[model samples]
Target: MPLPELSISDWQDAMAREKWTSADLVEGFLAQIAALDSAGPCLRSVIEINPDAMQIAEALDQERQAGAVRGPLHGIPVIIKDSIDTADRMLTTAGSLALVGNHASQDATCVRRLREAGAVILAKSNMSEWGYMRSTRPCSGWSSRGGQTRNPHVLDRSPLGSSSGSAAATAANLCVASVGAEVDGSIVRPASANGIVGMKPTVGLISRYGIIGVAEPQDTAGPMARCVEDIATMMNALVGADPKDPTTSRCNARPMVNYRKMLRPDALAGARLGVARECFSGHEGTKGVIETAIRALRDLGADIVDPVQASELPFFGPMELELFQYGVRANINRYLSTHPGAQVRDFDELIEFNNRHAADVMPYFGQEFFELAREKGHWDDERCLHIQSELRRLARDDGIDKALEKHRLDAIIAPTEGSPAFAIDTVVGDHILPFGCSTPPAVAGYPHISVPAGFVNDLPVGLSFFGAADEDAKLIGYAFAFEQAVQARRAPRFLATKS
Candidate 1:
């Protein structure tokens, strides 16, 4: 039987009408993963499938039959990046072999929330080892535990990382939606490259309590799905203040609006959108696609601010790298220390473990970035503190804020990435074009979303919509409008290679 291209609401309606049970949904997805992920294309997107998923689905179905739906996400299947912790049988290794046997003592705040909302924890997706902070020339989805995750659109093309598997799986419809974490481009880039909807919510909006850390200041987990409505559906379950993560305290004070309700088809009618033209200077094919998308936005009533050059701001890249180094050393250690029974206790121990197991762990690339981070001082060191302050000021106040304030814009639009999926080259490493606009909003701790824009040579490209901190609702509205107007997303053909 051919399953429909079901959204969250569609799945809910199906269940409500007795067309499918939660167990049926889980089994269907599992079969797809076996056929598409494991044997057919060998996408290698999933690291570990939850052994208890079907049982959980059966229980959820029983509950639903008894007149109790947990919430909007009741019995929804969700794939989460491996970096996020779950207390279940799955290992939270972040794609590293060093932590192969490591298990979390309890569920990460995000997982707990998802479970409470009745989202079935389908599986853990592969990722760049340690969120791509291990080596300078790291391959996006090449992990020791789970090998390269191939893009479903073109089997040999790269699936952008560190959220590579999440994006790939979602685009392939292995699950209804997937959760991904991003420090810079992990979520958006992969979603853009794989042709899906990826949201990197404001850093504090989603709790980072159980997620493997890259940089606390910039790291966040959000939804990757086929449509903006599905992304919003996941966001509705993801948002809320968590006592475990202090950063979410501010979320409580803010107005709690249904993100799904904010999706207005006419949202772009009077909205001012700034085009980050500096980011538009990449592959001509990608540029042409994004240019067409921009024109479509204009045709749909958006007030387009063309050629906005916020990418020219100084001190953004250097400061961000410095902060990441410090964050890797400090934040990772903090997570390791809090979680007991871990094979490695600190970053230095991790380095030693990698060296000891170099044959399996460091087969292709060395941990040069980890070594560099190890040499960095504490997060509170005078130099580190100074860099953090300057990064926020430059990226937020002088960068995105300057552009937004000057144009009185509601959001900024750019190519989510410079180009479509590049060929995977293990020897020379990822040749992906460097046309990312994630740095500014990432450093600013703001929200950003990537919606499928169009195709470049049969490969997917994404259009980015970003906004000021805590303006997640507004950005969602704008992205929804654009997504509905453009209707650019196409189902993946699972080609053997780029045609």
Candidate 2:
């Protein structure tokens, strides 16, 4: 039988009914990957397929037959970004060649949680080299190890960076769901561009141990799937305190609740949504799409606060760079020192390695960001500390919190990205249109969700709903309500070019 859309619930129902075994499901996905990922459209999304996947699936099927089912995710296939460590046959390269032969000593905290929940580590998705922080003008989804990950909707258009492969694979139904890491637009923008649901939970909600570092202050791992329910299911497995990552300790004070319970179609009836007008001033097509979404929200009984002015936080832009530069240098050095079998021991070594292998690593774009990061002073420098503190104050105290308080809003809404997918330009680099809603929440380490809003031309765009810190469940409910009302997500046709 042909596979359905394969949401978490659908997959579970099929498995419970014995319509397909875990092995069968794994084989189906693997076949699809072979035909579509790097063969048909040359998506180049999956960097490495898990060689032990079949064995794991067979074991899960045997366990299920003996009535030892683990949970909703038992035997489900999940694609994880290459930046996340798996400790198995797959290598965690962060889509760079420098870390090619190194194997992780253990699974990342999130990966371990997924395993405990009975998820099959299906494959490793490609990502922007070093999470798109290596160059001044980086190409979205272009990685040294895996090449370019193309958007399924239009093969020529970009699958926006960093988490590009995860979003693309999920949108194309190559897997039931995928895990992605974010340090700003990495999760939401790609999810939006690829027409899928992406959630960036509060920074501490998911542990970062074993994942390649981008910035400690803002980096997080979250779920990317075709629907909010799948995202919630993945979230259920990923949240917990890990001794390896101290940030998780913050979550212990407020333990995680099942996010699936919060998905109510009537969730918007009494919700108040504030529109961040700043994020809407993008392409006219994108603006119109978001305007239609606003109308849908209003029709769904939501109180709409149009043109909410929340983007004027002081030092919002500059301080983000300051924190990222300092944090990446310090955090990566710490991670590299402890990571097993890593060839490049520090930022300086990584730079030298890239320079030596410039033919492969710097074929299209140079590592200017890495060079600049190396020049940054220590994380505890007076200026760095001040910028970090001020950024938090402005983004949280004076930005999202202030807006919500003034309007008595449940969440803030904005266009997840500016345009759908720009044409891939390898020579000059990605022509990223000035459109995204990742900054305020990212800098504040708050929760953010992106849902498919509508299409612009033949490409997909997303509507973002973000809330104050630790409000992930509520945001999920709000986004689910919006998703149900809009019913905007559509399967990609894999068009050869934009219509």
Candidate 3:
């Protein structure tokens, strides 16, 4: 039997009506992974499957029969990015071979929350090795251990990263939903390219304790799903404070939000949404799609503020890269210090490991970023501190804030990416286009979401909605409204390549 394109709510209803059990869903998805991921289109989205998934689902099924349901995600199967430590039979390698023998002593805070809320850890999705902190020129989805993840829409097209597998798997329905981490465009870009709903919530909204990362300040894991409602549901479970991660201290003071309640179809009515026109560069097809999206917003009773003063938004490319290098050295070393079982326990050892095993790990690209990070000074160094302060001031205050304040806008909207998926080019590395809106939200540590806008030459494009920090629920409401109005997303056809 073929699986329907069911949302989380649909699956809940089906289980409640006795149409299917959690085990049945798990078996079906496993079969699909075997057929589609490994055989049919060979998307390579999943790095590894959880051996205990079916058994866990069976246990959940037993609980359901006994009149016990954990919560909204009771028995839901969720694929998490490889970087998230699960302390299961699965290895938390971050799509790198150096940590192949490593295992987490305990679950990552997010994974622990998901499990406690009755979400089955389905699989570990592949990602860019070391979260793309290993190389300046690297393929977005081509990890040393997991190979390349292909776009389901057009096989040869890029899936975008470092959350490529999570987005691709969610779009291809390999799992009910997936969690992906991002410092920059990792989550939203892949979500946009795969034509799914992805939200990079306020950095502290989701704890970063157990997840691997390149940067501490900006790194966060968020939900990617077929619809905004599903994203909202996942957020409710994922958001919480962890003592190990000091960044989530802000969440402790606020009561937990019922994100699903924020999902009103008419949420866009009378909302002042500013268009970041400067981020609408590159492909005309993508611009055209976003244009139609803008009109749809207007039709839905949104007050469109076009050409917001975003051209003045500072681009912190060089400084951000420098900070990432410094952070990779600091954060990765800290993580490794805890995971003593790993072969390469420090940044210096990791660099040496790659040099010793260059044929497999460095076949496509060298670890210049790793080398750079190793040579960088401490995070508290004068230059690093200056970089952090400037990033926040420019990206947060002078950037997104300037536009919203100037236009009296509720949120800012733009093309999530400059173009649709480009052809996957391993030799020359990722051809990521300019004019993406991910940088501001990423650096500001604010909330940002991407909803499928429409197709550009049969490949998907996404519209982004972002604003001030801690306004995640509001942004979700806007994206949900837009999503319900246009309903632009369609399932990928699994074409070998764009015609």
Candidate 4:
């Protein structure tokens, strides 16, 4: 069997049954990567294969030999996004050539947790250069360091990003599980594209101390997996408070651990679920699939409500999409400064770097947003504060909260993205319908999970489950039930012919 067809659970059970060793699994994935990466439809998802990956796997095998198991991820191979910091041999470039040979002095909070869980950091996956904020060129998995990552389903289609490679690789089964960060649609969009499960935990649920930041308010790390249970398995090991990130102090104040034990497939049997009508006016296929899901929820004994309204939305209108870019330029530059060997240390330096490498980096689009972010003022500025505040209130306090209150709902359901993979193009930016990752839980800093909804044209579509801030458990429970009920996940063929 191909390495790309195995799931996290598949590998875990194999290792426990002694059917396969950790070393064997790592070697299988690496061999599969070499066979399919540059040729065989060429889904160039991996940016850098960790030099010490096998060594780490050997150590995990030794521990297993000693009957010293860490957990479900005891010897699992995992992939990290380029934006994540890892104090290892792999470069943390955030997919930017500017940081081509950089190294992190420390691990990002989630990476540290993965290590503590005994998971091997398999490789650095490709990304939208600088988490897709480098330009508006619809880079989708294309990075100056690693070139474009094709959708495994259809070689010519786009694997929607920022976290494009992470989601694509997981769907292609390049790793057992993957960690991707979200500002807006980075995690969910690609998850939708790849027919997999993606969990964007509440912004502070998983610490962000060492992640390359985009928007502090919206930035978060999440688990990308083949199933909701796999997501839970990974998150159980990753979620916690880190003193390095003050945002995690909230979790420290509570001190809870092991979320998987709390999961129940029948958990949604008595929960309140809302349908956010405001988010789906134009997406007919998405609307149909979600309605089908709502019917299944009702069969599962859930109380469903329609037309839940979102309140106090931003006055910026469509300009709402660009708000996070300003946040990314400000925060990513600060983090890059701390990474030695990175070519660009600041936004000014990035623009200068792009200017110098225009032939390679700007072969498609200019750094328009980076220039605009350089012009924006401090966080306290009235303009920045007012819009960001409104974004949160609408997504959170007034919107999701209001719906939950009025309908007594426990969670909400919507489409994670407009549809499956579209044609990849550097000339045009994302062709997303206005209905995706727009409201629901994104702006609210709440928990949202996306799993395979269905397909349009052999391309995967995803359904999103959203709930209140800190309602991560319930949302996961609901998603797990839905995934079991629907069973829609399909492996990419990587066929000799494109769809």
Write the residue-wise lDDT of candidate 1 on 57-94 in tens digits: 99999999999999879999999999999998999999
lDDT of 3 by residue, 160-246 (tens): 979999999999989999999999989999999999999999999899989888888899999999999999999999999999899
What is candidate 2's lDDT per residue for 1-499, written digit by digit as tens? Answer: 3356868888888899998888988999998898889788878899999999999999999999999999999999999999998989889889988887879888999999999999999999999988988888899999889999999999999999699999999988899999999988899999999999999999999999988877788889999999999989999999999999999998789966999999999888989899998776559889899999999998989999987866564222666776778887887788788775778888899899999999999999999888888999998899888988888887888889999999998999999887778888889888876557888898889999999999988899899999888999999998998998889999998999975
Ranking by lDDT: 3, 2, 1, 4
Per-candidate clashes come to 0, 0, 0, 0
- TM-score for all predictions? 0.98, 0.98, 0.99, 0.95
Pairs that collide, model 4: none
Which regions of candidate 3 are displaced past 4 Å?
311-316
In terms of TM-score, how similar is model 4 to the real structure?
0.95
lDDT of 4 at 322: 53
Which candidate number would show the highest TM-score if scored against the true structure? Answer: 3
Tell me which of candidates 2 and 4 scores higher on TM-score.
Answer: 2
**Model 3 / residue 468 / CA error / Å:** 0.7
Q: Which residue window of length 10 is worst by lDDT in model 2?
A: 309-318
